[model samples]
Target chain A: MSSRREILDLLRENARYTTEDIARQTDFSVEEVAAAIEDFEEAGIVRGYQAVVDWGAVETEDERVRATVELNVALDRETNYGDIADRIAKFPEVTSLRLVSGDYDFDLEVEGDSMREVSHFISDKIAPIPEITQTVTHYIMESYKEQGMEFGDRDDDDRLSVSP
Target chain B: MTFEPADRVDQVPPSGIRRFFELAEEMDDIISLGVGEPDFTAPWAAREAAIASLERGRTSYTANRGKRELRERIARFEADKHELPYDPDEEILVTAGASEGLDLAFRALMNPGDAIAVVQPSYVSYVPDAIFAGAAVVDVPTRSEDEFKLTRDVLESSGAAEADALVYCYPNNPTGATMTGDELAEVAAFCREHDLVVFADEIYADLTYEHEHTSIATLPGMRERTIVFNGFSKAFAMTGFRLGYAMGPPEAIEAMNRIHQYTMLSAPTTAQYAAIEALDSCWEEVQEMTSQYDRRRKYVLSRFEDMGIDCFEAAGAFYAFPKCPWDDADEFAEALLQEEGVAVVPGSAFGEGGSGHLRVSYATGLPDLKEAMSRMESFLE
Candidate 1:
């Protein structure tokens, strides 16, 4: 439903950009930007905007843990991977879910405050699903990159303060 | 200590903004939108090639013209991009930068009292370089109404019709104006009729947004008359490397190399290697940078509109020239810097043709541009 692909791309990069900013950066007017975004939300093309937070970088009372949980399921023709995916997605810890190719049937990325919490959720909530035959959890020790951006130290702009 | 400088040196003024640059340099936390170069670093491929060349100890001076490989690549590049063909061995001479190429062209082609028609609101160097080469400058100013493009009519009115040669730039530095193919054809026809040798500065060729850049050399009968200047500084983000080249008819290029051999000897050897790699692999990077510049150009133009500043659409380069809302652009720039801590080049720094305007560069990051705009908004209020 969103005809303005550039606006979507810009919003995907940084959702914090205002309608005026998006309009300025793209070929749309302010009203057009607002209306296109409205149309996207109405058509369910754009679900929501979220910040790309580096939670590990933040010092807080509760440090978080993350893991990729591979779910292998044997499905009857009527109940597809979508059914098992739907049940697994209901858990708040599952940050991302994808029906991927290769050895894995479904890939689920889960996050929780502690390793124990994440492990417990995988065993208690996900394993109980009848269609899910196997669950393999791999805990992530570090993130060097994320969302097409580097996570840790980045290169500084080393150009001179001014030049012709 | 009492030695006098040459007469040509006295004829030209020192750069207008050295004091302004010194002031900005001494300021604290000033957001600068005054730069005329790309913000991106040189592509990794180019940097790696330079490092590799140094590591290999390829430190010797190249042939007086330049490295054969680099010239071949430049010839192929021009043929592919601008549709102009030149013999690499005979027609191309790599120089320190486009600035050097400009100087070399001026010195090689112009004689004393010969008039060189120069388009104003241009780069800071053109007029002085012409004067240094002993050419009378005819300032042919392009107006905002014409999108700052040079047409045959403007040429006729400005008396450039009588000049011995023409110095022209497109995707112009301060104004960011560009001409269409048909528009360039008119200028080409004018140059052809006047028998003027064309020194076309196409350094901003890749930064064009609205349409594919059309080189003046590609027009009918222009190839023989046009001396094209291009470089890696703006396109490949290789300003520090100081690599640029000139392409033209064999006789003109040979004359340029004659001066180059006595003075520069050759461009940097490592930079030549870097330029080879840049031409070989950095085109995608150039395209990426161009797209980013286009987006920023749109953002700046839109912001100017919202702020009710009169700015012509910058169809090409990364800078935007907006008419100063205040009476004097220089005073406005100084006041803005002192009050809001934002630095922009006053338009008069370019030429009298650019007076009453401010050259706002969008070469900085978007966040800085946004912040600068907000500060400018406050200053205006």
Candidate 2:
């Protein structure tokens, strides 16, 4: 039986392990390893690959204030959630969007130092849209963990592997 | 293709809490005092109970409301501690945490456009959850001079008598203030007169240093109108276990349980078992931890005072909200974390009237607290 440990062992030994290498390590046939990899990918056990870059080379600001903007929009209006999301997506500062079940229709992630920068984006750029009715912003004070390493480091072996 | 996509769903904004947390994550060497969680591990009895439950093959889901014994223990605890008698079978429901309890209460009681009167500088969840429930929130700001206490005057001034619900948090979160028996009686009277349903969060009740926590439900005529929310997370140091309960009138309890059944069948079974043990054998441990927190609280208050920061001694909870010498708490917190490696949440994070203050959690060990205070002193200097 192909156990989870065997699969993880193969991946840990070589994150870029080919099907042949996996088969050699786990004593499975190349075709079987390839099929298993396909299954893992489909199950989202293998997420996308990332190229590690040295922070010294990036030259980007390391830290700034982060806030979530919850927006309420008019349903029948021309400037709908899609229109507003598209507009927000174009802004370099907007990081992500999540559709939540309650309160607001959409939650936007924005980055800046001063409230003025955030207010300017909300009042001048976002709120001016005809479909947008109201917005509430919650500034995050401190985070114990963030998206990348913390989420990726879950003990569960349910993540997908993606080839670079 | 069908007709063009809807305009509204795309127009919604993002979450502000998520953004601030990201900046907090980036700062290196920052000693965060901003987290809401208590630093202690789950009491040994509770932890052992959970382990035993898992070993005994009780990993599957419990009843939607919760394990019978756990609910019974909660009911007994409430009746004994606060004199709020509740029938476990009819008047208590388990939730993921007090957070979920608050959410379930709102969902069960509020309809769109209903008004929810919330005390300002309260837990971040109340107003947001009220908004999420499609209710307009009317904020009643309490003064620092009053130690941020929620008095009957504040409730009356907010015109919450006409509101569908009044939300209160005592042994409160950001500000560590609490209400006395007499104060709660006044609140109970106001709610009774106005026919307003009260959602009382007493999560930090067990941590009071100077005074005992008095539940509004304990007062005459208040049991029918008040829903008391308490949890193992704070008192038993079981933040990770995510167990809490609500006690209210049978009808309100039934409504909340319906939502709980649909959304979350129950709190984790292991957590329920653990919580049962917590109620049985965890009081002494809680008192010990509370003592430790009390010491840290005093130390932090004095340190802030020495640094020329104005602060009031918190009566309960493990936080110290100190007025920032700099007018902007967010900026001060950001600078402290970046320069001195000490992190505290900006007071504005809690809501209006919190602008110039910073919330410093004394939940860490004494050594860490000392180091953090020293760093804070240097930063202020």
C-alpha RMSD by candidate, in order: 3.1, 26.4
Candidate 2 chain B: worst-modelled 10 consecutive residues by lDDT: B8-17
Candidate 1 docking DockQ: 0.50
Interface RMSD of 2: 20.6
lDDT of 1: 0.89
lDDT of 2 by residue, B164-248 (tens): 7889788877888888898778878888888888899999989887788888888888888889999988878898898998889
TM-score of 2: 0.67
Best by TM-score: 1
lDDT of 1 by residue, B308-378 (tens): 99998888878899999997998998899888999988888887578889989899888899999989988
Clashing pairs in 1: none
Alpha-carbon runs more than 4 Å astray in model 2:
A1-164, B1-17
The lDDT per prediction is: 0.89, 0.77
Best by lDDT: 1
Model 1 misplaced stretches (Cα beyond 4 Å): A1-3, A69-84, A99-108, A119-138, A152-162, B1-4, B49-64
